[model samples]
Target: MNARIPTDLSSSLKAEEDSNHSDNPSFDTVLAARLSRRGLLRGGAGTVGTVVLGGMGLTACGGGDDPAPTTPPAPGTPTETLLGFGAVAKSLADMVVVPAGYTASVLYALGDPLNAGTAAYKNDGTDTGFENRAGDHHDGMEWFGLDAAGKASATATARGLLAMNHEATTDELRSSFFLHANGGTTTLPRPAAEVDKETAIHGVSIVEVQQAAGKWTTVQNSAFNHRLTCLSDNIQLNGPARGNALMVTKYSTTGVQTRGTLNNCGTGKTPWGSFVTGEENWAGYFTRASTDDTARGGATAKSVVSLKRYGRNAGSRSRHGWETGGADDKYARWNVGQSGASLDGSDDYRNELNTFGYIVEMDAYDKTQMPRKRTALGRFAHESAAFGKPVVGQPLAVYMGDDSRGEYIYKFVSTKTWVAADANPANRITTGDSYLDAGKLYVAKFASDGSGSWVELAMSNPLISGYATYAFADQADVLVNARLAADAVGATKMDRPEWCSTNVNNGEIYFTLTNNSNRAIDSASMPPDSANPRVYEDTKGASTSKGNVNGHILRVKEGAAGNAALVFTWDVYVFGAESGAAAGSVNLSSLTSDQDFSSPDGLAFSPSTGILWIQTDDGAYTDVTNCMMLAALPGTVGDGAKKTLSYTKADTTTLSVDTYVGQAPTADKLKRFLVGPKSCEITGMCETPDGKAMFINIQHPGETTAMADIADPTKYASQWPSNAGYGAGKRPRSATIVITKTDGGRIGS
Candidate 1:
């Protein structure tokens, strides 16, 4: 299944190029620019009664009795000692579990200074003493290696580079919305000083780390350490959308570059040691003023037509509008709709909104080249773009997901096969374009028999022309408005699909359906079937929350159709649950303390060892256990049994979760490996090429804060590594935790 990076697939490229050039979009009256924006992102549960991760077993909830509690069983069962880390109880909290013989430590934490001079970050959001530094909510990550003697300074870690993503934030004390001494509102637009900090906090940070006794350590201030932030003095843009009219603004006449990237999420590391980060949900940044979103009259004014497509028709507030302070175009260009008449696109921000949501590539070793946004990925909330095994002269293919309710999953297959030397800078993006910028985009439609098809999202397709719901203007419009196009094509609606990981041993794609609650029983929305199980209420903790919280994972086999092919096979792999929950049949595999979980998110399969690793991000069941990591030995498609899901919906209608059910792992199959700190997420899995050191991001361990309690230490939900109270001497910030064996053996050995 390895794809050559040089393969060409030009016939399939879809573009959403930037239509403006320059920082200011205020003068072109004929093309007046208004920032079009609006979004009420529901943070919890699925729209359906329940959404399973990559593998949810039951198609529908059947009447079954809850298992009664019994006397505690023995410590060990029939589990494999080699795969099981062993069951070990934690010292803190009511009950956070981990595998046996494994230990967790804080490599670094929020507000802890990486270098000597810079002051630590204060959770109060008042750490004015800032240069470039690590931000909150570290989510995705990757690693790079250097020789044993490659240290740049005496204080540097042995040798290696670490790149991590800070996904999003839920800052309370720093913001006026969560509480209030700051007038309960942003008193004014962000000042340059504050704007500067905000910008600095948004991009990726590259740091050097070395290993000792199998454990990795950081190299503070190594020349290789660098931060790429939102307020990056400036960056050059490249690609079909680079110098187009849609990209020009008062800031840059050439229209080939922009200042920063946002919503950096899931990652992909190349065979040549490069890193690809996706910018998801970028459309929400621009502020649109006009109510009308008409595209006719070629009218520059926002019309109802254009507004609905981009989720911004009018009367919507923009996100973190730091641009509101000054009339200067530098601050004004953030808005994207139409308003003023500045010519040459200087006053039109509408087109610029099209510039983001791309797959940006960066050479971990060097940052000289301006990262290019792979527009061919079809702009949406890109979850993560992962490449299949790369081989010389083989077609290059990448799998990606649009992280939103009712969106589609896509893959890019190159027309030109990959070449070994194509790994260099001379071929970096240009080479990526030969493959990335021009490949077919397909939407997955799950079938009733556990089979699926990759419906091509092409404008000429009958689904596009024959659709009764919407019209496709062109390929550009098709990809830009991909969701509607997907629905029109009858793409199967999933339950808030999130991160996707590939099983390297078998090239199977595993994704998480992180719970859903919006699904109205029998409503116009897609109904739950055997593939998307559950339609009942969950009563784990507080009951105010409704819908399914426990999730499941979906596993698919490539079936040699290549990434762009139309046919594939799939099934449910694992269902997250609480230990003593329900029917053995409903519980699927009858999960135990080692495998019990809710809302599985991050997943990865080791290339060197072929082991599938899973991580969780739970809001529904944290009251029982903190976030955790697990290990599994998974089989490819066509290897599981088939069964239909059937259930009773909240409205009394019966529904099913999926087309085919999955085989449950034995009691010893999946086991808990590690647990993370309080209020933090354990994400971004990666290991040394040799399978030694492992790295994971501990994001925002203590993220909760209130306006009035900003100054109180005890009110802090979590005082992670420092344990010194909220932002005490040190600010509570997200940090990467490194784990390995003290005996110099393979992890989980």
Candidate 2:
């Protein structure tokens, strides 16, 4: 669902990178020359090398002129161990198909009751009180166990609080609910009640769930069961932008607080006990009047540049018309137009757009506390915030990805180092305030030779201060317009970076670049780089799709400096492609028929087993198989050989695309573990501390069906979880499922 919005800034930024690097030789050219000279080294000829922060190089062998260690001093053993589970056959069935020994059951579904007063979900579209029910399009989620006293418990597996994000909505119209009047089009103003119901279902859900006798059920009326929507007043703004003049609005004239979180996609858990929810695709949910740009900025070049770079240009209408619901400020805030008094722009919601698109941190144990927007993490289309292994009295690192094509990866190092006593603290918000409230953010600039550097995004940087279009006034300005700062520093444009997970074993980081359609569309956009090595055709029914449709996962090894490391080595862990494609071409991993997948979206490493779970949200190769999830046992970087692909150009010429491919996947290494129902995406998953229960989210089933067929239940694209005997209807709904091994052993073992 995050890929729905088309990124307009992608091409412009790609073009900027092309022109910026035209005069200076590219990183590939420099690395190629270095490798050519190191050809004499027996094992270092074709492998990825390391590049230090100050333009120094280290060969794979220990013979480079620069004196940093050629081989990274190895870290301690990983916290998790691999539990090998045999592969499950791929399927397009209208059910969740897991491996031979696994059994899955619905724990909760959209419209399921969260309060004791609400009736069970009818699944017939007449259900209401979505404010007290499960939200739709569940994306990222995490588990925080609770003891009998209702505090954060690390090992309490049977009873715990499950916090999950409801990212977006499915297109299936509800005929019974009045919300579907006129097909629920955003072109016209919607009814207030209809809009209120829709708004209530678009945030995060915190529910208390328990498993007894192998059955998981929601604890209705539990105090922990609550929902936070885009309309909740309990959300607060923190960090440097808090109380800043740029954030003043009618809702929060002091700029210290605002209403709810929006479009929460991926989620992360802090070293202290809290949930870090990434707000993504939130820019497309606000409306800007046709004349808003010039009137708001008033010829200020910096203001205009910041507005356009964040896709807040005038005449832009969001995907919904919540602004048209009524004259109330609750709905009016959705419209970011300059309609009211303009002297300070505080009478209207003109500054409301600046409030969203942040990583919101919430204390899972303390529901009374307000959610804080960690603005120090830089504002962008954040996909996830993964913290590296914390060291006592050492700095903490949080990695994040902006989930738009041609965006950059970011790292935030806390100003306050980690203190061992802070872990499992009595109050997580206080811990968050100490570490997350202040930090130095850095953007990644990857090179072709499997090496990279972190460019700090500071206002003190000459490149940021001297940026021609946007002038940086202070740290807050740079944080507010993070994309501009990343562009000024020339960070490597990734292919829609998504969920990131740090290897608990070695503190190595991995992120999903969830495909970019703009790359190589023409000479105007970016061509395939060594990092993103695919720009081939993937044909679907009568139409051919280009660009990296089948996305890949990247592995990063930080230098011995650990969380604060400025230099790192990297390589592609695996490439997503059709199994039957050319062995070494599009299917770079040499996947077989049963192991193939596309658009690797949701990626999580099991804390108990260390197995990597890769989920897909694909339309590229859906004709042959539905979206699915796989279990992978990945080797470290540089475990495989270099790869090269010859691309036949439009003019009948050929271009060679060479990249560092990781070890080839085998049946035992990476295998399909589960296939989702038709039209659904397998997004988020989490495991119990004991590793007995695994929770997975299936989102947006029956999404492809036409809204006009709402009256005909038979025309629905899927009847999942319901047909699987959970709910009672032919309509499909997003639901959370629990998977466990039949033998009562740890999952995937």
In order of appearance, the predictions have TM-scores of 0.80, 0.88
Please provide, for model 2 over 484-571, each residue's C-alpha lDDT reduced to its tens digit, 9 standing for 90 to 100: 8988888877778999998766677889987877566233345677787776666666766677778999988888888899999899
Worst 10 contiguous positions by lDDT, candidate 1: 1-10
lDDT of 1: 0.56
- For residues 308-401, what per-residue lDDT tens digits would candidate 1 score against the true structure? 4455545434555656747766567776656556655665555666666777777666667566666666767776677776667667767877
In terms of lDDT, model 2 sits at 0.75
- Name the top TM-score candidate: 2
Per-residue error for 173 in candidate 2, Å, reads 10
Per-candidate local distance difference test: 0.56, 0.75
Q: Candidate 1, 303: how far from true, in Å?
A: 6.8
